[model samples]
Target: MSINHTLKTQPVTPAHVQQEVKLAQRNLANSTPKENTTPEKGTDVKLSALTQHIKADSPRDIDMERVEKIKDAIRNGELKMDYDKIAQALLQNILDDR
Candidate 1:
């Protein structure tokens, strides 16, 4: 048996496709093994990266509000990232991941 397919890496959006293309270009430039593609904080894809505001309508973008709320929480002493909660959530995620 034989199988062949070409997987062309492409952007997931139209408005921000250019950014994805640029990231792809950078990815090609800094090509490495799949295991090593993600290097570090500055080099890796993060949750915050997924929080981009695509629409101009503020109400449409929940991430923007969430980000703002998080910043406000930090500023107003209303937010608390307990390690226990983090651990629990991580555990839940690991369980759910399976």
Candidate 2:
């Protein structure tokens, strides 16, 4: 037995191209700027207390000693990782964000 299938597709015409262009223009004009974009002048900014504290208390330098200790632990097979628990926590974090 033999089976055959045919599919029909529309060719892009000038009219379709013009319509798509207009649609893209309209979408661009209607879209709002993202929050991470620089704010306009005179815009008031506020940070939460936790954010302010984090900004103030954040260390400027990396803790090389801690990093080396972790690296040594991993090399020596002394680093115990609860991978299942870590994976669960990561999955929970992702789901919570959604």
Candidate 3:
């Protein structure tokens, strides 16, 4: 026994597409250039009270030694990770967000 199949396809019309492409090209050609609005040197800028407070309250001290020790431990494969605690913390954060 032999089986045969036939597929039908519609012809595409480029006239509509050509018109859209021409319109886009004309629009792009006629578009105006944007003006630069950058602030000049010696411009006085003011920050909000909340922003000032946050900046003042932020910590300036960073323990680079501790950071380097942790990085070294990870590189030496000597870092012990509590996966259960991390997972619990992550799940708690998601629940809190919801």
Candidate 4:
């Protein structure tokens, strides 16, 4: 899980670290930049001719059941999940149950 960085050789100087930080920030910025338009616009522009609506729900009841379990865990203190952890766990639970 360890990732290589500029620090693999000499200790990172302020300039080197700053450059790395900027590059990383740029990468993060690029990753989440807003799409120019919604998918609904694609067909109208002929950029894409076809589309399918995604069903945004699990196929199994177990997903919802797991959510109830996790919510109960939080409410009853069987587990304490932070905001990020709770969101992650919510996704994981859906996948797990699915």
TM-score of each: 0.31, 0.38, 0.49, 0.25
Candidate 4 structure quality by residue, lDDT tens digits, 1-98: 54654454675578888999999999999899696856654444423333322333447736888898999998998986479988998999999997
Clashing residue pairs in candidate 2 (N, C-alpha, C atoms within 3 angstroms): none
User: Which predicted model would earn the best lDDT?
Assistant: 2
Q: Which ten residues in a row have the lowest lDDT in candidate 1?
A: 48-57
Candidate 4, run of 10 with poorest lDDT: 46-55
lDDT on C-alpha atoms for all candidate structures: 0.77, 0.87, 0.86, 0.74
State the local distance difference test value for candidate 1: 0.77
Q: How close is candidate 2 to the true structure, as a TM-score?
A: 0.38
Q: Per-residue CA lDDT of candidate 3, range 1-98, in tens?
A: 43665567788769989899999999997796657958677968899998888778544556878899999999999999999999999999999999
- What are the runs in model 4 whose C-alpha is more than 4 Å off? 1-62, 80-98
In terms of TM-score, which candidate is stronger, 1 or 3? 3
Q: What is residue 42's positional error in candidate 2, in angstroms?
A: 14
In model 4, the Cα lDDT at residue 28 comes to: 97
1-98 per-residue lDDT for model 1 (tens digits): 43676677875677588789999999997886566456566666545533554423576546787898899999999998799989999999999999
Ranked by TM-score from best down, the candidates are 3, 2, 1, 4
